[model samples]
Target: MAVQANFENIASYLQQFSHDRSIPPLEKWNPDYCGEMDLVIKANGEWWHEGRPIRRQKMVDLFAKILWKEQDDYFLKTPVEKIKIQVEDAPLLISAVDQVEIDGKQYLQMTTQNQDVFVIDAEHPIYMRAFDGEMRPYVKVRYELEALVQRNVFYHLVNYGELYDEPNCTCLKLHSGDAQFTLCM
Candidate 1:
């Protein structure tokens, strides 16, 4: 899935000072595209897809409650955004970009449905070189992602007012809850 996917333009748009045909591709500003994976979740319940009985609701709710609400990374509490499912059909992508926004912008988020999601074991060398400040491994990337997500979600939850309050979340805890004491609920 990583090799056969698309980049949703999260990076700042590329700039070409001038269309110099003599310019080498490597010399020109070009950013490698990052691949994404999607998940399609289903449960054992009566669902009316175009009008058909598919998986049950219990299964869907189970995923949402356990992985998502329970705050499981690679599940929901991860850095993923714009999660939607192609319900009532033989599994499809559900676009959730109509509402969610980040840094005054809206973008498509990567996700995996109907499959057990896994984080990449190491960070891309390019990310390390570009982002600079932090030396993040693949596992660390997920935490950093979740940290960004935590901030955005925190702000959104606050604006919605539906959520009165939220607990403090950090990137370190999301990576590997080894010997460190995370601010647990």
Candidate 2:
């Protein structure tokens, strides 16, 4: 069937980059732009193609692994091709958060909808970005990619935040590992 063939092609293309379940080296790939793909990542974190939602979790995970952001555009990159895709907001969403303590230090661990888990640290700092006239929380996920923290998750994060007085205003500060993030300026 056409679907099976397409899936096999994608799997084969991805096989060379699969080692220890790490992300593919997208920065090393200099593929030519192959134009647009009929794919869209909705603001609500839904992945759609050709007017229908992509219902397979494995397929979505595979696509997420190939996602790359260049300047203001998003693309799915392979060794030989780079295809643009639409992203309404961020390409991913932070769906869950957990507070973990180690050696008397607390760390916030966030999980994306794609099941990617990362600790909020210096490398993965959270920041506020204006979205729809309101400042929302976003965190750096990987190279040039960010994940918008969902409303409920943001609220959960707020529970662990503290109000710190700055020279100009009061700021909500959240800590994870040795890094501190300001939710607002």
Candidate 3:
């Protein structure tokens, strides 16, 4: 009974931001722990629940809205409930990138699989990690969550990377305005 009521409240709150692109104020929510959910965000950024894939884009986007992270764990949070969810790699994937130049400064903006846009700047920096001798890149999304930069998107970013001369050696760096993010060591 309480779980049903909490789900109703969560649904109502989600409805309020159904058409809005801005993310809901999840940080302000103080929901009760609703235990673990079957929801799992796979390494490829597919959302699943009850061992089945969630196929509807709109529904997936709605779930992504309520996604929250706490000290390395992911949860679907609302004003009345906080349900833990499994994340194989990242909560989302960087599906596309849009680059622009303003006043001679370059800006790289990336869009997540859930349609959330983030600019690669100080607040949202890109980091690369080597896994099995392959380079994997990630960009900070929000709420301490990061989106894995897809392979094709990473190749595109490599085209924009410039060779920078550091004090010790030359390294490849991606630039956005005055901020320079080293792509490689």
Q: Candidate 3: TM-score?
A: 0.86
The TM-score leader among the candidates is: 3
Worst 10 residues of 2 by lDDT: 1-10
Model 2 misplaced stretches (Cα beyond 4 Å): 1-21, 102-104, 164-170
TM-score of 1: 0.17
Over 37-151, each residue of candidate 3 has an lDDT whose tens digit, in order, gives 7678998888877788989887788888888999989998987789888998888899998788878777998998889987899999999876456667888888988889998
The order of the candidates by TM-score, greatest first, is 3, 2, 1
For model 1, the local distance difference test gives: 0.25
**lDDT tens readout by residue for model 2, 1-185:** 24334445565787665543467888999988777767899988899887899998767777788899999999988887777889999998999999999778999999988788989998888998887787778999998799999999988887889977888766789989788888765
lDDT of 1 by residue, 4-120 (tens): 122121111112212221212222223332332244332221333233443654333223321221123222221223222222211212111113345654322322232223322
Local error of candidate 1 at 144, Å? 13
Model 1, position 132: C-alpha lDDT score: 36
| Cα error, candidate 3, residue 120 (Å) | 0.6
- In lDDT terms, which candidate is top? 2
lDDT of all predictions, in order shown? 0.25, 0.84, 0.83
Residue pairs with clashing backbones, model 2: none
Which of the two, 1 or 2, has more TM-score? 2
